[model samples]
Every structure is written in structure tokens, then in C-alpha cells.
Target: MSDPSMTTTGTMTSTRSLSYIALFAAVIAVFGLIPKIDLPFGVPITLQSLGIMLVGCLLGPKRAFYTIGLFLVAVALGLPLLSGGRGGIGVFVAPSAGFLLGWWVGAVVCGLCMRQFMRRMPDAKGKSLLIAAFLSSVIGGILAMYLFGILGLMLAAHLTLVQASLAVLAFIPGDLVKCVICAVLVQSVVRGMPAWRLDRD
Candidate 1:
């Protein structure tokens, strides 16, 4: 197998890593298809973002970002892979589009944080990995998600910043839960198959 972070030339493997990226993207779409809770705020709480966190932690920052980019491309292609089986460009115009767009940034940020912390710690056990993953999800991923989500809400729902923030409060609990779930799952994967992490660089 190849390091997802590098190419045959030993440079960053942006192009060659597409296969792994596409695989994770398909996984995201498939996870999105499962029936899930939809908050009244128009943001559906799905496993897709949780999956995003795993890709970030396990695949490292670059590959994780690429995977999420591919996932968005799939959604943009009218795959009906989003929550509630929604598809097409209209999804981008929807209120939850901010969250969708944030997926990329969130994954990248989360991956970066994991890489930084994991390096300092060097041997993150299950507990350490869980804590690192949790913080990464909350500070890096969810924050980015909310930033984009709030912007989307302001535009799509036609609310002021304050109003949008208040409106999105409904999603806080669900997002926290999702973050926890993601952290645990990612830690478990690391413990079970540490080799699966394609690139630590």
C-alpha cells in the first residue's frame, strides 16, 4: 500500500490518493442514506459527519480533506445521498448547506489538530485518542460547521446573525452527541487497526 500523503515521486500524493478519497466519499454517501433525526432548524443530524471525523483522524489531514471534497462532489452530482434522500443543486441552496460546506474545513481542521496533538503525545492510547478526537471534533470540526451553518441560515432562512445563532441552538445537543460518537469510533478504529491510518505525515 502507499502512503496517502505522498505520491510515487514522494511528494504529496494529491492525485494518486484519489482512490482512497473516493472510497471514503462513497462511504459518506452510503452512511447519509440511513434514516436519521432531522432537527427543526433544517439541519439533519446524520452519521455522515461522524464518518468525516473518522476519515480525518485515520486518513490524516490531506487525505481526509480530499475524501470530504469528493463527498461534496458526489452530493453536487445529484446523487440523492444527502439526509432525507435529498439531492441536486437545491441542497446547496438549502439552510443546511452551510453545514454541508463546512464538512471540508471541519475535516481538514480536525485532521490537523489530531496530527499536531498526536505528534506531541506520540503514543496516544484509546483514552488519549478519544480525548484528542473529542476536542478536535468540537473545536475544529463543529465550530467550522456552525460558522458555515450560521452563514447559510442567515442567507437561506433570512435571519440576522443573532437570530441565526439562536435558531441553531436547537442543533447543539445533537451535534455534541455526534461529536462524542465520532470520537469514540475513531479511537476504536485506531486501536483495532492502527495500520489503516494511511499517512501520519
Candidate 2:
């Protein structure tokens, strides 16, 4: 016979996971409120990248994937969820579409890397996270993200490879800054709530 306590615990875990997913999705939407700075080459810079970094670092692979998927679905539903309140199906065909794909991939990559890093780290909290988070963000948030962003520019915006790469450069500095912010925030959470365990794949 299954213990009633075990069943209750399992239910609570599932509920907590759903709550975290919803919270992160909303966080991404809130980040979209930051004004986007349009680049002459297309693809504006926004704080939404930072939110993506945080979601991955905090939520892990599976949850991070779901969180990004949820946010994108909401955008597809005509919600003004993208930066500058731009949303709807049109955005998917926009030059930023590739970057949208990046958000999905980047989050998972970041989470996977963070999980590995945390596992290996002896301290897990000292320099335990800041460096791990920063490096993971750079790998996933910047590198993985840029790969898709460039493709989006070329395919959606019809820019040449050279033009797309240059355009992507415009957003790199801001993305790096976001990485730093994400690292600090994740470290804070690790230190402050050492016991908080969210479902992470």
C-alpha cells in the first residue's frame, strides 16, 4: 500500500513545480515591459534576455523549457507580451523570431550546464554559483542565443550573413550585462533560500 504521506508529498511537489513555472512565465512577461532599443540592423535589445537567463539558472532544464514555451505561447495568443508590447503571430515571422527560438534552446542549455556545475562544485554556494551562473549564461544566453538570432535575421529579415553577424554584435554587450545580473540574482537565491528545491531535470 502506498503511504498517504508519500502521496501528499508527491502532490505537493507537482503543485510547487507548476507554481514556479507560472511565476517564471510571468517574470518573462514583466521583463518585456522594459523598452526595447531598436538597432538599425533590426532586432532590438531588451531585458527579456536577463529573464531567460534567470529562468534557466533557477528552474533547470525541464522546467526552464516549459517556462519559455509558456511565455512564447502567450505571445502567440495575441498577448502584448513582447517588448514594446509587440505580440501576435506576426512576431514569429519577424526578424526577432530566431531569437525567440534561442530563448527556448538557451534556457535548457543554461539549466543543463548549471546542474552539472552545481554538482561538481564543492561549495555549491560560495563562489559556488556566481561563476557557474555567469559562464552558463555566456554559453547558453549569449552563444546559443546568438546562433539563432543570426539565423532569424538572415531568414526573416533577409540580411546577408555579414549583416546579420554585425547586427547580432549590437546586442552582445547588453546580453553580457544581463548575464552578470542573472548570476548575482541566482547566487542571492542560493544563499538566502538554501533549502528551496524546485523540480529540475
Candidate 3:
């Protein structure tokens, strides 16, 4: 027979996990509320990526992936939860769709990188945290996203690979800035509230 105490503990953990997922989903929605800057390449720039990065860094890989999946599902269900108040099935066919889909992989990659670094340096502190954060964001938030973003541009815009690649370059500078911001913010959270740290496992 299963121990009642163990069952209760498991239930509590599940509840906590769901709460975190919901909270981050709300955060992503809030980020989408920020006005986006439409570019000539047909994709708009928004702060939602910042929210995604934070989820990856804070929640770890599995939780971050599930959280992002929930957010995407909400958007798919016709919720106005995307940048520029856009949502619904139609958004999935838009030029920015690749980036939107890429966010899922990006979060997973970011979380994996963070977990790897954290494991290597279990006592990661101060500057170490910053380095881990930066590296994780660059790999997950930029590289992974661009791979899909470029492909999305090519398919949606009917552009050549070269053209799509060039168009994506415009976003690099801003994304680098975002990476730095994510690193700093994550370090601050870690230092200010130790208890809030999610399990790396």
C-alpha cells in the first residue's frame, strides 16, 4: 500500500509545479502586451523573448518547455496572448511563426545549458551565474531561435536563404542586449531570493 504521507507530498509537488507553469504563462502574456516594432522583413520585435529566457533560466529544461508549451496552446486557442495582440490559428501561418515555434526549442536549449553549467559548478555564484546565464541565452535564445527564424522567413516570405539570413541579422544586436539583461536579472533573482531557485534536476 502506498503511504498516505507520500501521496500528499506528491500532490503538493504537482500543485507547486502547476502553479509555476501558470505564473510563467501569465508573465509571457504580460510580455506580449508590450508594443512590438514591426520590421521590413515582416517579423516584429517584442519583449516576449525576455520572458522565455527567464523561464528557461528559472524553471530548468522540463518545466520551461512545459510552461512555453502551455503559453503556445493558449495563443492557439484564440487568446490575444501574442505580441501586437495577435493570436489564433492564423498566427501560426504568419511570417513570424517560425520564431514563435522556435521559442519552444529555445527554452529547452537554454534550460539544458543552464542545467549543465549549474551541475558543473554546483556552487555557481555572482560572476559564475552571469557567465552561465549569458552562454545559455546565447545558445538557446539566439542560435536556436535564428535557425528557425531564418527558415521561417524563407518559407513565409518566399525569400532566398541569403536574403532571409541577412534579414535576421537586424535582430542580432537587440538580442545580444537581451542576453545581457537576462543574465543580470537572473543573477539578481538568485541573490535576492535563494529559496525561489528551482530544482536543476
Candidate 4:
């Protein structure tokens, strides 16, 4: 027979994990509420990506991916949880769909990068945290997202690859700034609240 104590422990762990996932999902939704800056290409820039970066850095890969997945599910269900109160299944057919989908992929990549960095430099501090966070965010948050965003533009907007590439250039500067912010915030948490270090989980 299964041990009752073990079953209870497992249930508790699952509940805790679910709570964390819900919390991060809410964070993404909150970030999405930030006003968006519409660009000439019809794509708007928003702070939601910053939330993705933070989730990746703090939750690690598996949990971050699940968190993002939950957020996407909510948006798909017609909840006004995306930037500018956008949501519903129609979003999947929009020009930004690729970027939206990219959030999950990016979070996974970012989480993997963070996990590797933490393993290699277990005691990363100050500038080290910044360096780690920046590189991870660049690879996962920016590069991965661009790949999907470009594809989205090409398919949804019927733009040529070159045009899509050009369109994405406008977002690079802002994404870099977000990377810096994510890195700094992560470093602050790591330094000030050791017990809350998500990587340790």
C-alpha cells in the first residue's frame, strides 16, 4: 500500500507548485496591462516580455515554461490579459502571434541558460549576476523571440523575410533595455533575499 504520509507530501508539493505557477501567470497578465507603444509596422511594444524574462530568471526552465503556458491559455480563452486589453482566439491569427508563442519558447531557453549559469557559478553576485542575466535574456528573450516574431510577420502580414527582419530591428533597443532591467532586478533579489532565490528551487 502507498504511504499516506508520502501521498500527503506529494499533494502539498503539487499545490505549492500550482500556486507559484498561478502567481507568475498573474505577473505576466499585470505586465500586459502596461500601455503599449504602437510602431509603424502595426506591431506594438509592451512590457510583457520583461515579465517573461523575470519568470525565466526566477522560476527556472520547467516552471517558467508552464507559467507562460498558463498565461497563453488564459489569453486564448478570451481573457483581456494581453497588452492593450487584447485577447481571445483571434490573437492567434494576428501578426503578433508568433511573438506571443515565442514567449513560452523564450522562457524555456532563458530558464535553461539561467540554470546552467547557476550551476557553473553557484555564487554569482553583483556584476556576475548582471552578466549572466544579460546573456541569458539576450539569447532566450531577444533572439528566440525575434525568430518567432519574424515568422509571424512573414505569415500573418505577408511580408518578405527581409522586410520582417527590418521591422524587428526597431524592437532591439527596447528589448536590450528590458534585459538590463531584468538582470538588475534578479541581482537585487539574489542579494537581498537569499531564501527567495528561485534558482535554488
- Top TM-score hit: 3
Model 3 misplaced stretches (Cα beyond 4 Å): 37-44
Residue pairs of candidate 4 with colliding backbone atoms? none
lDDT for position 171 in model 1: 73
Candidates ranked by lDDT, best first? Answer: 3, 4, 2, 1
Across residues 75-185, which tens digit of lDDT does each residue of candidate 1 receive? 788888886788888889888788887888888888888888788887778787789888888866678778988998899989999999998787777888878987888
Q: Per-model C-alpha lDDT, please?
A: 0.78, 0.88, 0.89, 0.88
Model 2 segments beyond 4 Å from truth?
36-44, 197-199
Score candidate 2 by TM-score against the native.
0.91
**How many angstroms is residue 136 displaced in model 1 relative to the true structure, after the best TM-score fit?**
0.8
Worst 10 residues of 3 by lDDT: 192-201
| Collision count for each candidate, in order | 0, 0, 0, 0
**Per-residue lDDT of candidate 2, residues 1-201 (tens digit):** 999999999999999989999999999999899787766666577889899999888999999999999999999999999888989999999888999999999999999888888778745665656899999899999999889999999998899999999977867877887899999999888778887542257
Clashes of 3: 0
Provide the TM-score for each candidate, comma-separated. 0.84, 0.91, 0.92, 0.90
